[model samples]
Target: MARRDFPRRSDPERSPAPREREPGQTSFLGRWLRRLLVWGTALTLLAAMALAVAVFVTERSLPSYERMKSTQTGQTIVVRASDGSEIVTLGPSYGRWVPYERIPQTLKDAILSVEDRRFEDHWGVDPVGIARSVWVRIQYGQWRQGASTITQQLARNIFLNNSRTFDRKIREALLALAIERKFTKDQVLELYLNKVYFGGGAYGVDSAARKFFGHSGEQLSLAEASIIAGLVKAPSHYSPTADPDAAVKRAKTVLGTMVRANKLTPAESAAVDLKGVKFASEQGQNSARYFTDWVLPQLDLVLPDNDQPIEVWTTLEPAAQHAATDAIQANVPKGAQGALVSLDRDGAVLAMIGGTDYVTSNYNRAVNAVRQPGSAWKLFVYLAALEAGYTPDAKVKDEPVTIDGWSPRNSGGTYAGEIDVRSAFAYSKNTVAAQLGNEVGFGAVANMARRFGITTPINTMPAMVLGSSNVRVIDMVRAFAAVSAKGSAITPYGIRKITSTEGEVLYSHRPDPVQQLVPNYVAAGITDLLQSAVSIGTGRAAQIGRPVAGKTGTTSSNKDGWFLGFSSGITTGVWMGRDDARPVPGLQGGTAPARAFAAFMKIATAKRPPERFDTEVKLPQWQLEPDDESMQANPDGYFYADPDGNIIEPGAQGRTPSADSVVPSGEQGVPVPEGAPAAAGDDFLNRATGRQNEPPRPKPKPSQSPKPN
Candidate 1:
């Protein structure tokens, strides 16, 4: 009873009373202790608020408009043809930029409905919209939605690399908030429009408009604008180039979104009027767009934007281009491809054909191709010798001789016994040329080729004297032009001048003529010899009824065929072959490409006067070396000795090689028999029956060796 009275307050089933405890312990707290605990919590909250304010103040401020503007900027490649017509294209991607006033209402409505309904009202980060997006994403069990405003997109594109990381997300949020403070809603929309990609080489609304409807941004129709707007999420999936049907379907979905968001009433949606729009031709407007592709890389080094809007005045001659193109299309044999180029005497490329049809295949045969020049290389060999003071009349034995394990053969099967330089060239005797190249120093021939602008990899082996190494058609044109110009080596050029759109001159190409190569007489000799090539050698098919000088070349097995010749005023080079190196049967430079050359030059040289090389240059006469005389024991119809010590001949084994006599296996170079008659005058240089002199003997393939230090 006493315990109950003493504790009267300590009821087990009700409220307990305070209890005394040891030094640092208490059973229940008094009113003062409770107040202290409450006050401590309030102070802790105040400190946290102060720290947060300090953090907010510490962040460096950045301009919102600058961030937005940076995001929308992109790279664009505007290609213009040599004729100054726009063609082809490429770009750096972001949002498709459009002017605010030019944006279609339909496009604006669709984008707003899908991306940010309150884009105009929010200051970039919309709390309510984010909450709604989170709810939707959670319900869908995946992140299928976002609440990012246009400003957020700008922040991500401009200041961030394309990475999906948490840090980036935080940065995006901060940047978005900053952007809203600087740019107006309309300005932000404009930046967004100009920054996005619509695929198919389109960047920004203006580019997209030009690409899809062949019009500017201001002229875009509602349907065109909607199509572009639909490409925001995935440009490739909705691109007309990649998937037109998918693009249209995506555009329709955008329209549906606009309807659902009440951005467009049902009646308004129905009345908005859209027709399926057809995009511009993916190939572009310039007819010679492939040629433009050839010129762009060079122009990038000399223009504004590194690629666009520069007016490039070029040396392209439409007439020459048409002729070359028509010739290739009409003459390239089945299963065989070909290329051709025409240049003025000054080495300006008037016309270039990359291939038979650039649209079907973009490989540039005119410049990129590097194949054996075969006997055509003889021009350089002979030129070097002539420059070294040897005359075309100089006698060299056409007999087979081995040089450093390489036995160069004549184009025919047999070796001519004795031959003068001119006859050996006309006949394309491999043995004689190889020997001559060796005598003059392989370096001489190589240096001569380099001076002519043959910048490709060179094989300095003695075999290169016989055109054993590879050379490009463009380089060959410059090389041949040296012979046509009588000495000066002119650099080949396509672009003549470049100017900004505002008409300020940026760069101009001056004809860079250099006399680094053959002297005038030596050049004339080479030219005269090459004239024989078209008149009576492997390039007979290229012969025109004018003073034309050029060379013909056929690599072993007909893997390559070429005819590079020119008149006094114009130089043209033609090549025919497969890109994959497949053997071309029943085709040679003399037949197809040579024919094309003839056709093009017929039109090209119609108005030009007949001109001949200056044959009066007092180059020293050449005598037949004894060693060379022994090799000419089997001389073919290709060589003859003159009192002046010069020999002239053609490549055929006899006056006329029987069709059956033509070598069957395409391996060995053509050979000539001994005692073959010398070519009399220029007629002696002309081919007998328009038949290619047999290809020269195959040199021993060089050994693969490690380069020496």
Candidate 2:
């Protein structure tokens, strides 16, 4: 009866019997849940263990807290002027450290607003900041945001090297956390402020403030504080000294950040006048940028590979540098460029103006530009001629001449026939120079130039006598310095001595053994001729109150103009031209370049007493003139004429050649036929024959012929 009335304990059709169970479904779900829970717990434990291991490794590798406290900043290179004044700080330099209590609150607030807004509220590691930075990086597909707090930066700077690595980042975080534990918030802020790099060789906030605002950190205004704060991210790019506009823009951004953070109200932010934020004057700044740039590359040779600071005593005379800069700026035309180099008698560079403005152009024309010396190069030619038994009194014909179909005429197309060597040089007579070069051989001239330290290539052609070859202004100065130094070879130098901060001598310039580059007599003779040049020649503009010896040069087409001169104490060279080599209309070495040289020399020699060039030269036997009257007569008829216009009778010495003796074309020394009609434009005969008086030929234009070069 119970079985019959059981009502079907499980009536599948009426009771909507439990859906047929999928094979192993219940067991599978239970097993899955158990496995998931077990694996999840294991993964969690593994992750926790890994993190613990990482933290342990990072903490173990960290520098000692005491070591962090004693972190030494980068070494500084102190470049000093010749008078022992600090001209510039070459390497990293830190200012006096400022304590936490001395820091202005506005600076702190500005820095926090721009760099790390959560600096005071969060621990060393701000997780929320890190999450936002990561999201930003993902969105930008680059490292656009740095999650590092000021504490992290301080840790990295003081304890770790600058390296971009996951390990380094993890280590930085651990060290930052350790720092937070070891020091208070104020202490951390103080360390960060005092140890950060602020570019322009400044390493601390106080230094940055002093360097940018010429004031201490405690005196920072809101605008100044914001500017300084903005430089912490990219010191060089935002340095006020390098890029003021960018720095101002960055400061405005920081001000906006301050306003947003409620540290500054809209009104205060608007009132922060960046224009009123006075930057430190560039007056005391390193004006010898060209010299400094030249000296920096040589430091490696003088100093050992050590971290110690060094002092480089350079030969730069600030007064001379200023004079040179002023002269070049004042004399150089608007479209033209100029370079000046001044050296002591010993070849030490006293002043160098590489260009009109170092900020705009740094092409060091004085040392690097190799342009035609033009007539200035005649010094070497005359020197070579003197060495070859020629005297300043030797006679040379300044007549129309052609060498290998290359005809070089005088600048004005007028010739002064048969002049003394000194007279020819004074006038920069091209024909006379060519004749002398032919006699002495171009090789000798080139060799003489090399002996005086001209390293540029010199062509062994007749045109080389007129400075057709290229040479540097420094070479010209060095060559002339040898003349001033009594023919001793000179190695142009700038650094006088280099010493470590501890007073140990790293290097001292011991001048190389001086070899005689030119004979004393030859130097004296050349000096006599150049002195004549300044007093009576194209270089008359270069003559200061004191006696000066120099040569003026103008290249073909007036492309380059130069004046190289020297006093007893200093030798200087000035060059002016367009960098493009385009002719400067109406430009000549006797004009602007000579004037600049004179201006600079006047200042350079103001303290020194005037001294005349040594001119006591003994002539060699071959340089002597013959005593015979006929031999002494100028066979080329280049002699002084009498008032009667008749050929003067030969005195015991000589006489001017008669018009009948005038050599005809294609003839060497043949006399013209008697009663030959006077050649057209024979101004010489108009003065010589006293017959057929004619108006003097019109003086040719100044540019009648291209300059010899």
- lDDT values, one for every candidate: 0.69, 0.80
Q: List, residue by residue over 1-709, the lDDT tens digit for candidate 2.
A: 3545545476567676568877856677899998999999999999878866766665676566445544656777877789976678866765556788999989899889988999987778889899999899889998788899999998888878889999999888887876776678998898888778888878778768877887777788888889999999899999999999999999999999999999999999998899777798654543488888788788777665866667889999999999999999999877998989899988799999888887778778888888998999999889877776567887888899987677889988999888898999999999888877776677777888888888988899788899989998889989988888878887889999987644678889888887877667788999999999999999999989999999999999999999998985799999999999999987799999999999999999999999978987885322322111111123234432232222322241243345554543454444433433222235455655585666545544654431222
Model 1 misplaced regions, further than 4 Å: 1-60, 63-79, 84-110, 131-145, 161-170, 253-276, 284-370, 382-447, 455-465, 493-529, 535-537, 543-548, 556-559, 567-570, 576-584, 596-709
- RMSD values, in order shown: 15.1, 15.2
Residue-level lDDT of model 1, residues 427-546, one tens digit each, is: 788887877777666777787777677888778887788677788888888888777777777777778777653456778887664664555567667766776666776677777777
Steric clash pairs (candidate 2): 645-688
